[model samples]
Target: MDPFVVVVLSLSFLLLLSLWRQSSGRRNLPPGPTPLPIIGNFHLIDMKNTRQSFSNFSKTYGPVYTLYFGSQPTVVLYGYEALKEALIDHGEEFSGRGSFPMLEKVFKGKGIAFSNGNVWKAKRLFTVNTLRNLGMGRRTIEEKVQEEAQWLVKELKKTNGSPYDPHFIMGCAPCNVICSIIFQNRFDYEDKDFLSLIGKVNECSKILTTPECQENGNQQTIYSLDHLASLVTGLFFAGTESTGTTMRCALLLLLKHPHITAKVQEEIDHVIGRHRRPSMQDRIHMPYTNAMVHEVQRYADIAPNSMVHEMTCDTKFRNYFLPKGTTVIASLTSVLQDSKEFPNPEMFDPAHFLDGNGNFKKSDYFMPFSTGKRVCVGQSLASMELFLFLTTILQNFKLKPLVDPKDIDITPIGSIFSTIPPTFQMCFIPI
Candidate 1:
């Protein structure tokens, strides 16, 4: 072929490419703000700060909206109804976990949390069954939690009414409980390796949620083994930080509302007595305490964007075509805050989980661990830990803020990962 002919062919090819993109763009994806070329809607997205941005986007584009980060098209699901429909009604179709370049390079699909398809199924089943077999919902697990709670109480008592940050100490107790369950061991507070691991987990949480870390230019090419490591890091980080943060939030709420704390303590004292540690069996008799725990999970809503799933095949959602491989985020925060679901979404009221007769009432939208097939694998363990830890601490000691309640900040500071643990000193006055 002559040089002139080759040049003409190249120009024609470029023209066709542009036309093809334009045609494809006309497809009816769920409605959202128009995206700029190459970058898509990324410029408009605040990856660092997602909660408010996601809520605002949902308002303008409806509950289900489409967005583009680089070349990736993501679907954002907000509120209870949309989340339930996508995560539960069409769960299998939306079970594919989308991996960021860094995480894909790191976790290479080895763990239960990040792995998907048949491997994910196998791992998830094995984990859930193993937990159950190990007495997750039974007395054995409760004993472990109570033991950890005792250690936490001792640590708190050491503070001797002095103001100190409880975030790290409170987080570590539950973390150790999970560690004990999984690794079948516990770590001392001063263990260097354990402390290092905790720090790494916290750092990874911040790194994974940063918009800069997810940007096209920022992503590094990671192979299978590297990906596996990244996934493990992510799991450890998510598993520990989220539950720990929520526990801290629970303590904060108790401190801010002494009446609520007193009620829970009264129930514990009457049911379990201070002579022995409280166990799972006591949960049934302690309705008020159980309701308070459920309220903490609901109001905290720690893992705002629980986990991202992808469409495995082309599908129709409410007359809109969502193509295969589109990433979907289930905004758990919205579901927890839904007015129809929780009458007073903003107020931290235990009544949300109680009826007029003071009996425990179940709400369809109280999905702090999320709902559907890919729900939190450690849900049972987390519940046991929170209940035991909170009740145990409250039974023996009172939680009060080091500073005034007005000075305690509840606003979350970081994006993607919200760790809004109150920064106040509190004394554990022995009861």
Candidate 2:
């Protein structure tokens, strides 16, 4: 017998035994399509539409199911109830942050979004406190959002009803708001340094998959000065990206639905009027406008998968056991598009958030910033931003599409991570 053949047989036997053990170990996990070793269920996924793939998997596997991203078994909570149970009901148990490889290389497990255990809790607390100090969700922050909204309006006025590509302007407004919060000063839209920074922030998504983690002066470790840079980057990236994308998507949707846009403008006229900018106080009296904002978030459905979360401790949930550090996805797309909660959810209707009396109706399933213990730290800031910016724009200008409203495509040109509106030039016809 050849020794080479003997070695081959031994290796084959060991590999088979390891695979057998892997299959047997998954008995306690919920249930899903069986995964192949190594690549696991990568074959089961459409890499492009991963969230939709996860959502589709729910139809076959029911609400709670297991998937293997490589050898790691992931438990997905599909619909609203399952998500609420795991994320909110078992909040503490599921509070740990999970891995996003593209982000981990940059964050290095040092920041609020990706850090776990005590570091996560501390970082989160510090961030929340820092945001609060910077006037997040308060009247002070409202003023900042309003100021930016005014600046945005002024910038639009410069267009003088000419056709303009608003992509950069839309990004600049929210980016500056975050800049103020993080750096304590906003930049002029034309400033070269500010433009460069924005380029880096937007490029982070495009380039992160192959990101070379740049070295700074301090390279000690987590909690080191190098990590401090990662922390600020994490906050700045998150703060600007989602809010800006939502605003862009919301605007695109408005252009697509001229009648809906008319209604929102009508409400703005009736409540806040042109005399004053929309305020948080105005939000209560302006039910239709508020509903429109909420519906935009639901219908836009950016950040569909939300941030992946992890289990803090080994826990038995429902009939299956999820080990500590098990990655869990509470599908925001599933909850946002849940037909049960919002009738004809695929249609962009403000009535989904409105009642028979036309008052704003709150739905537990509206988790765009997501819900639970680890909900987006800037949720309040984002909400205020949406209302103020959207209303302000409508108050000053009527969004005129070059094509007919029916022809306008509201579909997001999304990447794996977030949604982006198609590149468009529109006439910001003054109201």
Candidate 1: which stretches are off by over 4 Å?
A: 1-23, 46-49, 209-238, 417-419
Q: What is the TM-score of each candidate against the true structure?
A: 0.86, 0.92
lDDT of 1: 0.76
Query: What lDDT does the true structure give each of the candidates?
Result: 0.76, 0.82
Give the top-scoring candidate (lDDT). 2
Candidate 2 residue spans exceeding 4 A from truth? 1-15, 207-224
- Model 2 lDDT per residue over 301-407, tens place: 88777778888899999978988888887788899998998999889999999889998899999999888988988888888888889999999998998898888
Q: Find the candidate with the highest TM-score and give its number.
A: 2
Candidate 2 lDDT (Cα, 0 to 1): 0.82
Q: Which ten residues in a row have the lowest lDDT in candidate 2?
A: 209-218
Error of 1 at 275 (Å): 2.5
